[model samples]
Target chain A: MRITALAGGVGGARFLRGLRTHLDRSPGLADTELTIIGNTGDDISLFGLRVCPDLDTLLYTLGGGIHEGQGWGRADESHRLLGELAAYGAVPQWFTLGDLDFGTHVVRSQWLGQGLSLSEVTTRLARRWGLPDQRITLLPMSDSPVETHVVVEDEDGQRAIHFQEWWVRYQASIPAQRFQAVGMDRATAAPGVLDAIRGADVVLLPPSNPVVSIGIILGVPGVRDALRGTTAPVVGVSPLIGGMPVRGHADACLAAIGVESTAAAVAGLYEDFLDGWLVAPEDEASVRLPRATVRSRPLLMTDTDAAADIAGAALDLARELAA
Target chain B: MRITALAGGVGGARFLRGLRTHLDRSPGLADTELTIIGNTGDDISLFGLRVCPDLDTLLYTLGGGIHEGQGWGRADESHRLLGELAAYGAVPQWFTLGDLDFGTHVVRSQWLGQGLSLSEVTTRLARRWGLPDQRITLLPMSDSPVETHVVVEDEDGQRAIHFQEWWVRYQASIPAQRFQAVGMDRATAAPGVLDAIRGADVVLLPPSNPVVSIGIILGVPGVRDALRGTTAPVVGVSPLIGGMPVRGHADACLAAIGVESTAAAVAGLYEDFLDGWLVAPEDEASVRLPRATVRSRPLLMTDTDAAADIAGAALDLARELAA
Candidate 1:
């Protein structure tokens, strides 16, 4: 079975960890091929080097080099590079770029400078992590530069900052007016992104940020149409469990888009394409989406085992909806 | 006093340390302005970053960040970036790029990509090290790219490899046919280079690699003529002592150029423009240059004190010649 998924950073990577564990243990599912369509909305260029945060999270997490404690970056990373950059008063010092992590960005930036597309560069990086040999393919939503910016009202006036600044630096302390994925209008889905959705046995949407993660992927031209038109069942796990995000600044981003931080509200945004929706048992009462199979389960991914159980629930829901 | 110096990497940096120490301790030389014309032939672009080995050596050494034992790079440097880079199978893993050093390259490469001349970029970097505030200026031999390539016979037939590959990786084991500083003919002296020589109270050549280091500096257009015509005496300290190079691959490089590794042979290369020469006391008997004021001293720069003593001797010789 080929499972196509969309992801962002930490939250999505953790959920996928569950799915990977589930796929490994499930009988007759040993041949499962995983295809991840990662969010490129968080991509930014610092000091002329292109940094793809979401793709790197997936690479580090799935490849087993991730800092298990922080849920992102290399395990043995050092911030010497970032510290040195800050000493020079280089801009945007808030976004933490570790020395070990900088190596990947350096290589990717060099390859991209030589005319390779984001997809090609991501593949090369993934290959370094032995992901391709594991039969897991990770692709960016689009080759085009699609950076998510957060519009916030500051002391001076309203201004837009890169999503990372709002998310990582400020901890989303200031109220966000809106979220914009710049350049999304012209970005076509990268090669194999549409195909993965169109031909997959199941399309799973991990619990990545909806306003900027999966939302940016769906904003790509022809992607929403492909998701709605695909023969495969589309299932999603709510990023929010009990009226709060399991991790990250998803709730703040959701509030900016005027969406209630509830599993039901989160699923309602995907009602047009979702064939199945998984919510926490406690939040099941609030969700009432039609056409999609509404299932409730223990959604807190406290461990890989818990994540596998949640992954199993999502996959079973998809199988039932298809039946 | 205004002193202009020509230099390379390790040896030059050590000599400059001594020179700086000497100026600091001398009663009337407290306000001495030092200008260094550093060799650019060893500069190479790695992973799209412009790595300037000599300039960085000067910066780290003089600015008090140099690795004391190695005479290059930052102290307390971490190799995490290089280790990660190697894991990705990035080529030329033989070259060690510490995390701290990579930061300088990133800033420089970005500045260069933004159309800043290398001299301007070097100034910016030196300012980060507070070099300008110290009344010391470091200029590249030329603003233009002039990488030294060592031509050698190999199993794949005769081919040119970067000087770093020959020096660092092969340890200059392969017999070099010739050292070619590609693009040397067109490279103009960087701004302030000619003026530094013309306005110099004294022009001093440190014990750098005479062939690839000081030799390439003179190869720049009008530099040798400036040295010959300048009213200030041109004095050189031999890198060789007791018929052997004090440090580095100078012996192999000289051998490749058909020059014997002797203080006398090395002085002959500088005879046309040299006004004074310093050889070790042991090798003074073998020297035969007639026009220059020949002197003997303890030439090995074993420590900053030794370097300062050597610097004093070179300055004294230049003063004697001027008298």
Candidate 2:
């Protein structure tokens, strides 16, 4: 069986890691292959090196190199490189890149500068993380550069800044007027991305930001169409629990797009294709969909086992909908 | 007094540091401004980051951040970044880059990618190293991209590889057939390079590699013309001690250009513009120049004081020639 998922940065990575653990432990599903389509809208060029935050998080978290406490960067990482960069007064000091993490961006930039596509680069990076050995193939959503920019009003008076500045720098305190994927019109789905969605036995959406993470990926040409056309049961795990995001500024992101910060509203964003929805126990009663089956579960993701339980519940919901 | 010097990597940087020390201690020379024209032929793009080895060595040495034992790179540096790059199987694993050194390359690449001239980028980097505070101005030989490629024959047959690969990786052992500055045909002298030489009260050449270092700088259009036309006495400290380079592969580099490994032969290369020559005491009798005054000194830069003494001798020779 093949399971395809669309992921964002931290939350999505953590949930996918849990799902991998669950699959490995299960008897019949142990041989199931997982294909992860990572959102690259958050990609930014920092210090002249291309940085793919979401893809790197998935690589680290799934490969057992993630800083558990931070849920993103590498474990046992040092910041001496960053300290030197700061000494030089290089800009955008808000986003932290550890010395170990810098290795990823450097090589990615080098390969990309050499004319390799983002998919090829991500495949190489995944190999280094031993993802192929675990029957996991990680790919960027699109090979073309697609950066999400946020429009905000501040002392500077209405300007568009890179999504990272608004998210990592400002902590999203300033109200965002809207989010724009700067190159979405030109971005075609990466090789195997459409096939993964159209041919999967089951499709899962991890608890990534609905407004920015998964939404930006869905904006890719033919991606939404592929989802709606696929015969597989599409299951989504809500990023929000009890009307609040478990991590990141999903509420602010939703506000920018004029969507309510609730599991139902989040599910509505995927209503065209979503056949199964997994929500937190407290929010399950409020989520009612005409075309999708709704289920309730404790979704704190307090530990690997708790996260596995949540992921296992979502898979079970998908299986029920398929049956 | 205004002093100008042409420099390379380790040896030149150490000599200049010593010169700076000497100038600071000397009564009248304390107020003197030093302008250094650094060779860019050895520059390489490692991992897509612009690595200006000669300029960085000068920065670290003059700024008191150099590793005294190694004569180059940052003191108290970590190799975590390189270690990670190696793990990713990035090529050219021979030339090591410490984490701190990577900071320099990262920012330089970033600025250069943003369309800043190499001279402007070097200025910003020099500012961080407090070169302005020391009243020291460092300029690259050419703002245009100029890389020295060496033609060598081994298992790969006759092909041109980057100068750094020949110097650092192979230790200059392959017996270079010839040295070619790849972009020198289209290259023009960087702003202030020619002016620094023409306007200097004294022009000194440190114990840098005569062929690859100083020789490459002279290849820039109008630089040698500036030296030939300048009124300032051009004095040079020999890199050789008893027909042998104190450090690096100066002999190999000289041999590549069909020149002998002798102070006399080196002085002959600059006979048209050289007004003063300081050689090792052992070579004083043999080094006979028709126009340039030949002098002898203990040229081994064993320590700061030794280097300073040699630099002072070169200045005294320049002053005597002027008188």
Candidate 3:
């Protein structure tokens, strides 16, 4: 089956890792072509270099070169460049460029500047890293620039902060009033983005930030409409399991969007498009959706094996919906 | 007394290292200010990050953090970031970037993007690196972008390549017809470049690439004018010891510019502005100069002490001219 997944950064990367592992292990699922539509809202320009955080995280993790300890950047990372940057009084000191990761950004930025679309650049990067050919395709949400900005009221006053500062710099400590994907209103889905969704036999939404990750992708023109009208079952895994996020500042983002941190609220957000919803067994009572048939399963991806098992369960639910 | 020095990358950095030692040990030069005018001809935009090769070399060397073995970059350097860059297929792979040195480039690029002058950025970077207050003022030749391009013709075709590609990638293996500083004609000298020369008590040119390094600096508007009019004696140490460069592809550059790789040929280039010329003792028999008084010395800087001795001999020549 051709399964397409929509992803953010950490959570999306983790879920994709599991899905990849599951496909590799399952005898019948070996032919599954996985196309990942990644959110580029978290992308930013730093030191005059374009940095796509989510795309890099996905690339590094899938390529087997991720820094396991930091859970981001390349393995055996060095801070020599970052130290020099700091010494030069570079602002927004919190967002660091690991030496190994800087290379990726530099290459990506160079290719982008040379008039290659994000999708084309991504394919080239993936090919260079020796990623499995034709089995998995990683697509940025749009070729156009779209930033996730957070409206916050700090002691200094109200202002819109870039997503990186709101997340990495402030660590989400301040009260955020709303999360806005700045240019999403005018952004058309990158070439092949909507097509990937329409062509897939199954579409899986991993437990990623709804307001920024999948939400930003859906916010792109015609993307949500395509997903809603697709004949294939669109399944979503709850970002909230037992009233808490699996990782990251999802709770804060959830609060910013005024959604209670619960599986039901998350399911409700995707209700119109979701044909199936998977929630952790502990949050079985919270699974209430009108359009989607909700199923409760063991959803904690604590390890690679556990993650694969979770992915398998989701695929099984999708198969049941197909039946 | 205030001294001005013209420099390139490794050789220039080494000479300055020795010069600093000499000045530090001299009782009469206890309060002397040293201003270094560094060559930015080797500067290139890699992956869109501005890298000033010669300036970083000088900074790392004078700041007591240079890689002793390489005579460039920082000691205890790591290639973690560079390895990652390669993994992403960055072009011009021959010019390696150590993790520590990358920090300097990142900071400078960041500041440059924010509209800071190269001189101002250099000062801030030098301060951050704990360079002694007022001990040395490093100046780039021009704030405007100027890249040294070598016009090479081979059996198949002919094209002008960037200095980095010619030196690092091809290692100057090809025969070159000419050397051109692509933007020099319209470029103005960087702020404080002329002022440093105008205010100097003595001006010394290190054994750097005469054609690309010192030559490019002179090509900048007002630089040669400042040197010609300065009351301070302008003296140059021969980069060509016998009939060859001590390091780098200076010989190829010299050939490209139709100048023989000889001490006298190098000294002749600065004849109009120079007051004294320092050539290696071996090349004294071949040396001939009318505009400047020629002096013979052991010019090879084998170690810090040797470098200091060379600096001392050059300064002594300047002192003799003043007397």
Name the candidate that leads on lDDT: 2
Clashes of each: 0, 0, 3
Sorting all predicted structures by TM-score, with the top scorer first, yields: 2, 1, 3
Clash total of candidate 1: 0
Candidate 3 lDDT by residue in tens digits, B182-281: 8888788888889999989999999998988999988888999999999999988999878889888888888887888888888878988989999989
Regions of candidate 2 where Cα sits further than 4 Å from its true position: none
What is the full ranking by DockQ, best candidate first?
Answer: 2, 1, 3
- Model 2 lDDT per residue over A191-264, tens place: 99999999999999999999889999999999999999999999999999999998899999999999999999
| Tens-digit per-residue lDDT, A1-323, candidate 3 | 89989999877887888988998899988899899999999999987778999988888888887886666787877667777677667766689777778887767877887898888899988886556563888889998999999999978899999999989998899879998888876788988888889988999999888878888888889888989988889988888878888778888988888888888988877878999989998998867788898898888878778878888888988999989
* Predicted complex 2: DockQ: 0.88
Residue clash pairs of candidate 2:
none
- Model 1 docking grade: medium
Candidates' lDDT values, in order?
A: 0.90, 0.93, 0.86
Estimate the overall C-alpha local distance difference test score of candidate 1: 0.90
Q: Write the per-residue lDDT of candidate 1 for residues A190-223, one digit (tens) a residue.
A: 9999999999999999888888898888899988
How much does candidate 1 score in TM-score? 0.97
Pairs clashing within candidate 3: A81-B103, A99-B81, A100-B81
DockQ winner between candidates 1 and 2? 2
Q: Which candidate, 1 or 2, would have the higher lDDT against the true structure?
A: 2
